[model samples]
Structures are given as C-alpha cells and as structure tokens.
Target: MALAGLKVIEIAGLAPAPFAGKVLADFGADVVRVDRSTSTMNLDVLAQNKRSIALNLKSPAGIEALIRLCEKADVVIEPFRPGVMERLGLGPEVLLKRNPRLIYARMTGFGQEGHYAKMAGHDINYLAISGVLNERSKSGKGQVVDAAMINGVNYLGSFVYNMNKAGALFQTPAGTGQLDGGAHFYDTYKTKDGLFMAVGAIEVEFYKLLLKGLELDEERDKLPEQTDSSNWPKMKALFTKIFLGKTQAEWIKIFDLTDACVTPVLDYYSMPTPTPAPRLLRTPAKASASNEGSDVFLEVGGHSKDILAEAGFSEVEIRDLVAKKAVAGAGLEKSSL
Candidate 1:
C-alpha cells in the first residue's frame, strides 16, 4: 500500500531486474512487465505481483507503445548491456526527454561507461571482480549472493575499493581473514546428526559464553588467546570435534536465549520468516502469493490489449498492432477490451 499510486514499467530481463520490479509490486506499485514476444525461461517467482504485456521491441509499433507507456510511468527499470536500450531508441536520454520526472534505472553487470561495461558477466563474475569472491570459508569455496550483481553494482560497495583505501585489509588466501573463517569462534561446524551450526560469538563476553556452553572452560588457560591467528586451526579442529558430539538441535537448546550467538544453519525449506525490522503497527510488511493461473509461467504478452488500451490506444490500433505481430496476448481475438 505504500506505493499504491506509483506506476512502474519493468523491461523483462533476467533475475535482478525482475526482482526489483517484484519488490515494487509487493509494495503496491502498479508494475507492468514488458516481456519479449519470445522467452526461453519461466521466471514465475520473480514475476509475482506484476502484470505482463508482450511486445516485439524490434518493431516500430512495439517501440512506440513502450514509449507511450513510459510517458506516464513514474519509474522504468531496464537491464541490458550499455548501448542496447539506446539502440532500441528507448534509452534514458530519449525517455527522460519525453517525461522529465521519470526515474530510469539501468541494471547491468558493470556500469554504463566503464571499460567492462559491454562485457558479458553474471553475479559470480561481479563478485570475483569486486574481491568478494576472494574471501571464502574454511572450505575454501567462494560464497555466492544470488541476484547480487544488480544491487552490488548499483548500491552495494565494491569491497576491494574500500579495502584499497583502508590499507589495513589485505588479500590472504581463503579462510585467513578474522571474520572470513580465520577466527575459530565465527565459523560453521557439522553436528553429530550431519546438520550444521553457525557460531558467531565475536564479542569477548559472547565468546566466553560460547566457551562455557561448549564446556571447554577447563581448557581455556591452556588455549591461545582468541585474537591469535596462529591458533585458529587448532581451535577450529577442537571446536569441530566437540560439535560433532552433539546434534544441531542439542547445541541450539544449550545456546537458546543465551549470548553464545550459536544457531542451526537452516536450509531453504526450513528457513524462518524474519520479522520486519523497525516493526510498524500500521502497514506492516506482508507476503503475498505469486500470481495464479497456468499462464503465469513462460507466457509473454498476456495483457497486450489491456495495457495498450490503458496507455490510450484505441481498439482498432490494438487490433492492428496484434495483427502486425508487434504485440500479442493470450486470446487477444476474444478479449473485448
């Protein structure tokens, strides 16, 4: 309801752009996804809470129809390589001129003007270039942030850039950073039942509580200081052996409501619903189901007539567009709009 009156046009692309549109739609914005006439993948989850209108961007009629929609849209989100939109005559420069107040958001792997702007890359590539991939867990495997390429390039910091300026941050091999698994107290361990537990007792008091909960207090005097990097492997091995003695649930019970900062690593299906932060009494966040219908997946141009009519096109014009193969929708011939 917060975005009840906002109008957004999202050019159909891959994961990130659709996700951005879905967030807007979830907040009550009228999000219309301009889908291509042909698409190879089904992105139903990302298409939830949004409407789809199939348009052939290669056609002049399709381009004109999109421009008309943008004239009234508050926002336009497009994900393409740097000159793609411009070549289609729908770039920010052209659209912003038609509607000066339009917020044209362009999503790409690299920025629009950089040397790597036109290069083909995905989330992993972006993370690698940004130095995020360089940091790994004790397993020596890089962690991936799905759909991170969009937010990472657009809003999130390039970690390497900050590290370069700070001068204190250095590139060691994986599992060598204080927080990136170099610290024994802040790593994951497998349990007796094959489940995993995440331990993050970073503060001194919390670390003390963790040791107490693990019943390793008797060996504290013999163990190296928590900040000593040289002792991490030994501490990690000891912790791993101790944790293997208990199931994930058993450890959770021991650390329940305590400052030990231990929790079971939940899988996707078992992940808990996090309460929205800064909880509001009014208009609180609520999850909505994906759009219903068999046509929800792998279908484009499902709302061509309705979208065109809403954009001030006449019935004759809509029919002509559809007939010309510039626009399409399911059962367009039978629709009375």
Candidate 2:
C-alpha cells in the first residue's frame, strides 16, 4: 500500500535480484518482470504479485519495446554481468535519458568494474572473496551457504567494518568468534529429539537465567569464567550434554517469556506465523491472493500481448512483433498476433 502507485521493471535473473523485486512487489509496487524468451527454473514463489513478459532483447524491436516500457517505469532493476545491457543498447544512460527520474539499479556479483566483474559467481563465491565464507569453512569442505546474499550486504555495516579498520578483525576459524559458537551461551545445541535450539543468552543476567533454566545453578559457582576462551570447550560440552536431555519444544516452553534468549530452530515447513517486522502500527504488510490458474504459471512471455498493449503498442503492432518473434506469450493465436 505504501508503494501502490510505484512502477518497477525488473529484468529477471537469479535469487538476489528476484528477491529485491519480490520485496517491492510485496509492498504494493506495480512490478513487471522482463523475462527472457526461454524459461529457466520454476520460481512461482518469487513470481508472486508480479507480471512477466518475455522479450528477445537481441532483436531491435524487442529492445525498442523495452525502452518504451522504461519510458513509463520509475525503476529498472537489471542483474547481469558488466556491459551486458550496454552492449544491448538498453543501459542506464539510454533508459535514463528517456525517463530522467528513473532509478537504474544494477545488481551484479562482482560489480560493474573490477577484475572479477565479468567472472561468473554465485552466492557462495561472493561470500568466499569477502572473508565470510573462509571464517565459516570447516576442514576445507564447502557447506551450503544460506541467505549469504543478504548477509553479505549486512556485513558492510559499521560494527564489523570498524573492527576491520582497527586491524582487530583477525580471520578466525569456525566456532572461534564470540558470537560464532565460541561460547556455550551463544550457540545452538541439539535436543533429545534430534532437533536444535538456538541459545543467545549473551548478557550476564540472561546467561544466569539460561543456567537456572537448565538446573545448573548449583554448578554455576564452580563453572569457569564466561569470557575466558579456554573455558569455552568444557562449558560447551556441559551445555550440550544437558540440552540433549530435553526436547527443543520442552526447552522453548521453559525459556518462553523468560530472559534466557532461547528459541527452537524452525524448518521452512514448520515456520509459524511471523510477527510483522518494522512494527508499523498502520499500513502493515498484507499478503495478496496470488493470480489464479495455470496461465499464471506459464513461462516468461505469458503476458506479452497485454504488456505490449499497456506500453502503447497497437494491437496490430503487438501481433506483428509476436509474428516476428520479438516477443512471446502463451495463447497468442496467429490471427491475434
């Protein structure tokens, strides 16, 4: 609702760019995804609340159609290697000139200029070069990195950056950092049922509460100091043994509404209703009913004719373009095209 009137043109790509577009669409922006003529993966979840049009950018008519679409768009989100759009004559300079107020957002792995700019990469590769992956590496085995794209963006903030500038952010192996499972109170523990519970009782009072919840209060006096790195392994072992004695749900019930800072590690299918973030008292985010029918699941160019007509193309012109294979969509009879 906050972005009800905003118009966004998102060039279809992989996870990160699509995710950004999804966020805009979720907030009520009129998002049109410019998809390639050929379909890729089935990304129905990411396609929610958006329209898709397939265009063959290599064709002059296709490029012109895109430029016309940009003429009415407030934002263009392009995710490609450097110079790809420029080579296609649809780069920022060309589009921005048509709509001077346009926000041309270029999302790329290595950025527009650099030695790695043209290099192919995924989320893991991006994190690998940024020192993050290395910190989490274990015995040289590559683990699947979850949400690394968003995490990489957050790593640019002040805290980690300031530490790096002070030359204090030394590269440490996995499970060694204060908040990276080095301490017993700030790690995940397996429960009796084989499920896991996340423990983030970082503050003194919270740590005390965690110990109390675990019925380890009597041993707290004999326990090693919390900040002493040498004591972490023994404390972690103690915590692990105690935690495995109870199920995750049992632990959650014990720590709920308390200061222990504990919660169960939820899987995707088991995720509960999320508490709305940003805590907006008004204009809260609402999920819209997805467009119905198999037509919504049709590959990229599914809405080609409609999108073309909306962009000021006459019915005849749209048909002509489709006949020339400059655009494609489902159910476009030759007579209509």
- Which residue runs does candidate 1 get wrong by more than 4 Å? 131-174, 218-221, 273-281, 290-299
Clashing pairs in 1: 54-301
Candidate with maximal lDDT: 1
Q: List the residue pairs that clash in candidate 2.
A: 54-301, 319-337
Question: Residue 82: error of model 1 in Å?
Answer: 1.0
**C-alpha RMSD between model 1 and the true structure:** 8.3
Over 1-337, each residue of candidate 1 has an lDDT whose tens digit, in order, gives 6668888999998887887887777777888999887654556557766788988899998898899999988788888888898999998778878876677777778777666778998777887676432323244332211223644754466565576468745456667866678889999999999999999998889999999999877475587888788888999999999999999899999998998999899997788643323343665443555344653454577677777888899988888887777887788866664
lDDT by residue (tens digit), candidate 2, 192-311: 999999999888888888889998763655887776778888889999999999998899889989988988899976886433244445665446454445533536776777887888
TM-scores across all candidates? 0.85, 0.85
The Cα local distance difference test for each model comes to 0.77, 0.76
